[model samples]
Target: MKTFLLRKVHITVCGRFKLNDMHILVNTRLLLPGRFTGVEWFTFETLRRLVKWHPDVKFSFLFDRPYHQDFVFGDNVQPIVAHPQSRHPFLWYLWFEYSVPKVIEATKPDLFLSPDGFLSLKATIPQISVIHDLNFVHQPEGLPWLTGWYYRYFFEKFAEKATRIATVSHYSANDIATTYNFDTNRIDVIGNGVGDDFFPTKEIPDLLELDSKPYFLFVGSLNPRKNILGMLKSFELFKLKYNLPHKLVIVGDPMFKLSEMQSFYSAMQFKSDVIFAGRREGSDLNKLYAHATALWFVSFFEGFGIPIIEAFRAGCPVLTSTTTSMPEVAGNAAILQEPENIEGIARDMYNLATDTLLVDQLKSKGTLRAQYYTWDKAAERLWDCINKSL
Candidate 1:
């Protein structure tokens, strides 16, 4: 009797959505300022387009903390600022359980979307959660204890609760299905898109460090999973032996277990050749991408490497990891390197800088591949998923 009733409810919910008349409440906490990482950017890019594309359908953006003005993408979109930023574990539980659920109930949204892979168990509405990567499950020790615990426990329940699952890559889709024991059919593979800002532009005055020196660019948060140490070691090896007048430019904010990495960094033989550009965005990031030797991003794991496509858009070659979703993203376009193998990474970096024919070939392939992925295409696909779920 319970099973039969559940089936009826499911059919009733998924059977119909008057697209023009529907309302959606999005968890826009990730869209706030000082957090334009891959996950946040994905949500912002998709929603900005979605709101404009569907004028009749109202989109309510729910932020857990004080909202930003730039997040208001359209007049058709409504903004709801709730309480508790939920930077900590207990706050996270409270926000999802009490605050967000209450807001949903009051809003009476036809559907709910959470791009951060968090779904409110209290909300009865159909929900779409974007599970970028299951790194917490795969690399538990990389994260703090409470964070890892929350992710492992709540995410399993959220996966079950989510009306539909959207993953960035087929690799991640498979992982989610196998790890969570979720239905594969329920997962939708919507790949991330390259932003418009990453075009072939002239270098700005911000980075005078790369004035005359050939350089290899590494763009990712300075963390263990990002293999920053590995990259540094590889760069050290390349400069020591090759004696190329090339610098290593690292662009990202320091995140997680950095003391040891910092200590190691200070002891580098070629530390002077490595320049940390810090976290960059907008025009500065585009300039960095535009005028780079090549992107060196051999992460240990990823749902999707957005920078691979960003480099593609910038008309720059990429040396990404052979493992995870990178091989899928590159698609014979960029050079693939083993993340853990520092020697291999160094060899590839050297090859990218020295070999003209190889670099040109990669650039050509990368530009062509970049065309296939754009914000418009991503928005359309995401909207289709949203429309169908409605």
Candidate 2:
């Protein structure tokens, strides 16, 4: 239906505007020099493919600073450093309103592509904004009050002004529609993909110097929404109930509510059993996933849970949330647990550890499910979404 509508509209839009003259200005600020967070990963992988696939079109990537050559994906790509890197809320407003608009004026782009869901209200060009979720709107306490205000204020208008919207999941598409009253039909769902590196490894490789006990993996930022407290409590419960030799390895830096988690972690009797593997990436994270007994990612909300698929690709059993996009993404390949229910989470954790048959079944199901998502496929969908917006 979306493709039909897009193709019908593209005929008229394409007739008026020559494809030969199309120059796309992408907001590549999310593609920081070295960092590849969830959003960053999406932008990089998709943009790399888009640039390669469309040589006829020119892609002018807008960065906040002097970007490294690593981010410059191709020859037809022109990298422009926009002023005022938006680290703070005020800086963000300045970057979008002032710096981004200024470049749009000079570049005179045929269309604008905002990979991180933030479209400049000031720009007159056609735009496609990839909004992952409205989590900030739903859970205001997840961010600072001012940051929350900025998201609500700008994003409502951003949704209104965008020519089209692309999201990571159908759940997020509906959430954005209900929250901001946007048309759901205009939204395209472009889900996430796990890389080839995440596949099952026969040996754990003794990476990160783990003690020999089997461990359940919880990979996410230490935020309130991640339910870190729940993970800790559930791990403790699992330890007490079964007396298993499994350790809980949490791999991510603290954010959102660090102090609250810090206080809780200090008081736990099984605190020693919980290993803080810290923020890891590439080989370190992949190895961690491959070796784990199961993946525990019962977060409160997610537009798409990338780690669930990463675990799936690693042939790891998954224990994820029953709500939001988790059940949608995990399908029947995981053990569903209510994120808030400590007892339920613990039971699933225990079940995943003990039930070897179930573990093997989930692993088989997950590996097959994981095969469906790939960057090449996502990039093709994203390209279609971008073309429709024009």
Candidate 3:
């Protein structure tokens, strides 16, 4: 093993090559067992492709938990589980910011990458932080006080210290640059790719029996930023105005303020029309997306709306918010409405459900639009940025 002391820590390079071999350390903190989200999917797919494409480079996946045997990697890729699982915020900070640096020092990696954004300020390694969005900076009221403070304080500092930064969308990249006063030149826009599984399936049936009528699908956590209240109100209006027999299917586990959502549900005029299908995976979610009247994802803000792209790929007409990155991702394939406008949402829902020609047009355009984003392209761009930074 070839070892180098770049900063205070020594990193070991395992692979021998005629060309200069760069040992890269990637933070795999978000890859918890049985958990999947947009960020996890992005990290997993990008890492998988990066390892495959670059055989000359040595890669290490550093995790805070025990390694899952099922996690796939290339021959040159190694897994390093250095810390025990932690739940406390203080412990998490200590583990990542303190313990991780020691591990990196020992390993002596040529480049350090933190995909979830925050990096240890103590480290001297050439670092790249994928600061997905500055949501905490923009909408602090939507998040818990401590959590919001931590993100705003730590991430801004991380951006400044990091050698390079990557974001999921152009909107996010601009926001990050403006918020942190960092030069836009240091930030790279690497949009996320829709998973191959989300595309239209011939096996999926057209109409599902959640009672007799089809349902409107809402995927993602029941959080304030998701604009769930707006969605419910819009659905109530749609049901009352059109007398539609369809249920409103919500497919995500509640992460915060359960009591608030339950209270809202109780007060709904058409409460009986709502169905909570809590956290689905695999073929079931694909089926839900394919059979829906249209995906209702009117979020107030987002780094990038992966579900919008997923719905489009699944041949479902989308009704997403006009705010943030939703319009950027949705393009003309979706029915974009203001998040605060309940009547606009109701009108679009009614339009999508009643108008056959509009639905057909959106479906056709979406299929072609969704084809533009791919994991290979994203991975290739990310690799190019990392190589350039090196």
Q: After superposing candidate 2 on the true structure, give the runs of residues whose Cα lies further than 4 Å from its correct spot.
A: 1-20, 205-209
Candidates 2 and 3, the one with greater lDDT = 2
Residue 363, model 2: Cα distance from true site in angstroms: 0.5
By descending TM-score, how would the candidates be arranged? 2, 1, 3
**CA displacement after TM-score superposition, residue 254 of candidate 2 (Å):** 1.0
Per-residue CA lDDT of model 2 for 1-390, tens digit only, reads 011122111100111223456799898887765467788889988999998998888888887766777877776677777666678899898878777777777668989999898888898999999999888877777788888899889899999999999999889999988988898889999988877678777766354445788898988778788888888889988888888888889888777866777888898888888888877887778888988989899999888989999999888899999989899999989999888899988888888888899989999999889878888889999999988888
TM-scores for all candidates? 0.93, 0.93, 0.92
Residue runs of model 3 more than 4 Å from their true location after superposition: 1-20, 202-209
Candidate 1 residue-wise lDDT, 67-159, digit = tens? 777887876677776666778889888778777777776658999988888888988889998999999998776788889999999999999
Error of 2 at 124 (Å): 0.6
Compute the lDDT of residue 99 as modeled in candidate 3. 67
TM-score of 2: 0.93
Clashes of each: 0, 0, 6
Deviation of model 3 at 151, angstroms:
0.7
